[model samples]
Target: MRYCIERLDGQHCLFVDGRKELLIYLKQASSETITDIRKVYRNGVSDSVLEIYLPYRKQ
Candidate 1:
């Protein structure tokens, strides 16, 4: 899986090539709680290439 930070529609987003569950977990990190978030699932053939988009906040 791969991870990167991006901005979509003027909002910070976390692009992760993995599960959507992981994205949710990341948004709720202990360092900074992210209350406003949106989840998006992209194309995936398997666990290795799954793409998930989640709202991200810099901590």
Candidate 2:
């Protein structure tokens, strides 16, 4: 399985895999949310890669 993550805003995130969709709610996420994301591949013999984008890190 492969996917891509995009930060919708400061309180929401979206994970997209090809045509599949997985919405991640971060309303209660803390500062550590940036590193609390996980992606796993379960399908075999597939040409896909998981792409994850963490929330904007405050500098």
Candidate 3:
């Protein structure tokens, strides 16, 4: 799957699979500030998909 970044709000951003609105949001950030952030693991549909983790998110 292809991944991309999007601005969800004034202070929030998202990194998601291209073409889908299902995304991950980050507070106090924007698309322009994306470079300042670090990306690690991601959760996706399969083992080969990016293993992104929503650590700060409340389960």
Task: Give the Å shift of residue 25 in candidate 1.
Answer: 5.2
Error of 1 at 32 (Å): 5.5
Best by lDDT: 1
Clashes of 2: 0
Cα lDDT listed for each candidate? 0.42, 0.38, 0.36
lDDT of 3 at 19: 24
Error at 18, model 2, angstroms = 12
Q: Which portions of model 2 show Cα errors greater than 4 Å?
A: 1-24, 43-52, 56-59
Per-residue CA lDDT of model 1 for 1-59, tens digit only, reads 44433334326655555445555556566423333333334553223221233334234
lDDT at residue 16 of model 3 (Cα atoms): 53
Ordered by lDDT, highest first, the candidates read: 1, 2, 3
Indicate the worst ten consecutive residues by lDDT in candidate 1.
Answer: 45-54
Instruction: Name the regions of candidate 3 deviating beyond 4 angstroms.
Output: 1-9, 21-59
lDDT of 2 by residue, 1-59 (tens): 44433333336444545333433333333445343333545743333222333333232
